[model samples]
Target: MKMTVFGAGYLGATHAACMAELGHEVLGVDTNRGKLAKLEAGDVPFYEPGLPEVLRRNIDQGRLNFTDSYAEAAAWAKTHFIAVGTPQKKGEFGADLSYIDAVIDELVPLLTDDAVLFGKSTVPVGTAARLTTRVSQLARDVDVEVSWNPEFLREGYAVADTLHPDRLVLGTRPGGRAEQVAREIYASLIVDGVPLLVTDLATAELVKVSANAFLATKISFINAVAEVCEAAGADIAALSDAIGRDPRIGRQFLNAGIGFGGGCLPKDIRAFMARAGELGADQALTLLREVDGINMRRRTRMVEIVRAASGTLIGSRIAVLGAAFKPGSDDVRDSPALNVAGQLQLNGAAVTVYDPHAMDNSRRLFPTLDYSTSAMEACEGADSVLVLTEWPEFVSLDPTSVSDVARGRNIIDGRYCLNRQDWESAGWTYHA
Candidate 1:
């Protein structure tokens, strides 16, 4: 199958490359010339583990390409996947659908024949049906079917997730040809035992946001427990271990840390709540507001812990261990780690950050904060160390070596992944 994926950002780029890896010819289209140029040159604009190699291999094998023109993309492939961003609107919780709307507006007018547009962007419910009507209005003498096929790729593991998805969902109107087209596009995965759920368009649109909302709820639930444990002088790690052993409550996002943050969860829950309010079912999702609050409070708690550990943040040097939201990707949007670092910086603390892959992105997001090449370098003369993101390297750091470099042997484990005994043994005051 040959397909054009519009909006070549994180989701679009990964989907394009992974589609090519699945033995399809893929053209990634975007308005950003720099992003297109980077993709064409086999350089991924963002940090994703194993994505660069997959992209490079697919492009080198002549199965993947990129372009900035929607007309060219329309002419190139009958199948189009809209993987554009539907980020939260400024000063509002609802998603800004201008980008998704622009893709349809630009491409539908240029289509001269039959086409199928799979909306892979996470969007508000009923968007696909609305876009279907819009596509019908714009397309001339052509049969264009709009379907919802939301992506479930994680940032760090996007390549693996796309190449071997756990499930494939295709949402279309009754009697539409989208099912057949999607079957052909995902035939390999279907054969590999990836279950395909065929549903109405609205259900497909709801799946992605619902999944994110549930995951966010889970993280916040555990973080809320962490708060109780803090007040009770209990260890969250032990509690998590005991409860996680129960099969009904699997411990995936149960780690109680400076809670969930990324591009997706923070805005998705807010959007979900906002959408529910618009639908007159606002009370049902009211707990998500609490979830959002708990997540934000964790970052604040981290700042308080840092301030307490350092005695006084004013004129103090603090080493921030990670900047990205998580361990494997360089995405700092709504990152709790960066939020903590920023708060400390605002309070007159001189903060230095170190991350394996997120340094450049962190600098771009926060140019004022100082960054270091390595953890040791970041800790040099620091009053206290704050391990924010649980990067594996940070987890395995030699506390003795870090102690020698720091002016003060004070460490706060925001992620709760570090060994307290080891840090204490190294003569560092360990706080969780």
Candidate 2:
């Protein structure tokens, strides 16, 4: 199978590499010259575990390659995967479809007859159906078919998620070539018992946002419970454990932390709300606004707890552990950890931040905060340490050693990743 993947950012780049690794000929297209240069040099722009090796191997084997030319991409593959970004529109909750629209506007005219374009980008529900008509009008003497196959891979474990998805969803026109081509493209997953759900374009487009909204709701649900736990003097970790035993309420995203703030979740829910409003179903998703508020409140509450613990944050030295939204990937689009760190800094706290792979990216986004090469270095003589993001390194940190480094022996377990008993045993005041 030969495929052209548009947008060589996190989603597109990972999809291209993973597709090539699946024994397909892939050409990744992006307009960013620097990103293209890096991809051409076999370098991944972001940190996704095991991606660089996969990228380098596939590129070396001549199966995965990248170019900036949409003309070349159109000519190269009959199956074109649009894995572009649909970031939130500024000042509006809806998604900005300029990139997806641009892709069709440019590629439709250039595509030959008998081509199928699969949009793997997460968009509003009606986008694919609209794109079908949009592409038909734009195409030059070509029968262009549009399909919605939303990508379900999370940032940290994207490669694995893509390669071995829980289920494969496709939204296409009735009995179209897109469905047949999609099966061929994902033959390995199909053989491995991955459920392939084919539906109308609207449902397929809604599926990705629905999945993300579910994840966000789960996190917010537990965080909402965490609030009750705080009031009732109950531990959220224990509560999550109790809830996890119930098969009906299986605990995957029940992580009670500073809350979810990744590239997905926050914006996807917002866009979903805006779309519902536009569709005249404003009351359908009114709870999502509350969900978003709960998630945001967790961050604010974390800062308040830290400030209360440290007396006056006016000149307090605070160390923030884990800058990335979550571990395994170095993306901080709406990172809760960094947001709290920045809020703390803005309120006059001397903040020191640390992450295994997110330091450079965090520093670029937040140059004011002091960054250290090591977690221990970040904690060196700090008045208090905030375990903002739950990374394995932070979770596995020796409590006594970390307490020994901090000036005040006080730790705020923002993500609830640490054991309170161990920190207290280590002569440190642990607050979760």
Candidate 3:
């Protein structure tokens, strides 16, 4: 199968590369000259576990290529995947669909024959229908078919999810060819018994937002329990362990920590809330507002716990372990861990932050905050340490050695990743 993925971003790049790896000829098109040049040179600008290798290998195999020209893309393939970013609008909860609009604006006029455009970005419901109308106006010789095919790849596990998704979803009109082609495109993954669900475009658009909303709700639900634990003197880690063992209410996102903050969850929930309100179902998602508030408050509360443990924080050295949202990737967008460090810095604390891969990216986001090359270096001479993100290295740190390095042996297990008894046994005052 030949395809064009319009937008060589995190999603598009991974999708294009993986599609190529799966024996499809894929041309990735992006208007950004620099990104196209980088891709052409086999350079991936972002850090995703195992992505660069797959991208480089596929490009070497001649199955994948990238270009800045939409004409090149439209002329090359019948299957076009609109994989651009539908970022949260500035000062508005709705997503900014301008990039998506621009893709159709640029590509449709140039499309010479009948083709299918599968929208892969998280979009407002009804966008596919609206786009279908707009695209027909742009085309001359051919009619453009628009369908919704929202992607569900987690950032760190994009390749595996794309290659072996738990399920494949395609939203199209009744008796549409888009669904059939999508099935063929994902045939190998489907043959392994990956469930495929086809539905109307509106339903498909809602699926991505709904999935993200559920995840955000789950994380906030556990954090709410953590708040209860704080008041009642209960250990959230122990409670999470006990509840997690029950198969019904599984403990996947039940980590009672400074809750989820990444590119997806925060924006998606807010956008969903805003969209629901527009759809006159505001009451249905009002809980998400509380969820967002609870998640944000944890960062502030974690800072307060650290300040209390350190006595006066005005001149105290605080080491914040973990700057990324979660480990395995350097991306720090809407990072809860970094948010705590920033708040602490504002309250006159000298905060030194560290993450295995995100320290450099963290420094870029907050250059004023001191960054350390190693987790141990970060903890050196600190009045208190806050385990913000549960990076494996932070979890495995020897509490005794950490205690010896710090000015005051104060540990605030914000993520509850540490063994509280071990830190206390090492002569450290623990606050979680």
Per model, state how many residue pairs clash: 0, 0, 0
lDDT, candidate 3, 32-135, per-residue tens? 89988988888876778888889999999999999988889989998999999888899988888999999999999888888999999998777899898998
Error of 1 at 179 (Å): 0.5
Q: How would you encode candidate 1's per-residue C-alpha lDDT over 1-432 as one tens digit per residue?
A: 889999888899999999999999999999999888998999999998899999999999999999998878989999999999989999999999999999999999999989999999999888998998999999999999999999999988899999888999889999988999999999989999999999899899888889999999999999999999999999899999899999899878899999999889999999889988998999999999999999999988888888888889999999999999998899999899999999999999999999999988899899999999999999999999999999999999999899889999899998989999999998999998
Which residue segments of model 1 deviate by more than 4 Å?
Answer: none
The whole-model lDDT of each prediction reads 0.93, 0.91, 0.88
lDDT of 3 at 292: 92
Q: What TM-score, to 2 decimals, does candidate 2 have?
A: 0.98
Candidate 1 residue 107 Cα shift, in angstroms, is 0.5
Every model's Cα RMSD, please? Answer: 0.8, 1.0, 1.5
TM-score, predicted candidate 3 vs. hidden true structure? 0.96
> How do all models score by TM-score?
0.99, 0.98, 0.96
Report how far residue 140 has shifted in candidate 2, in Å.
Answer: 0.9
Candidates ranked by TM-score: 1, 2, 3
lDDT pick, better of 1 and 3: 1
Winner on lDDT (2 vs 3):
2
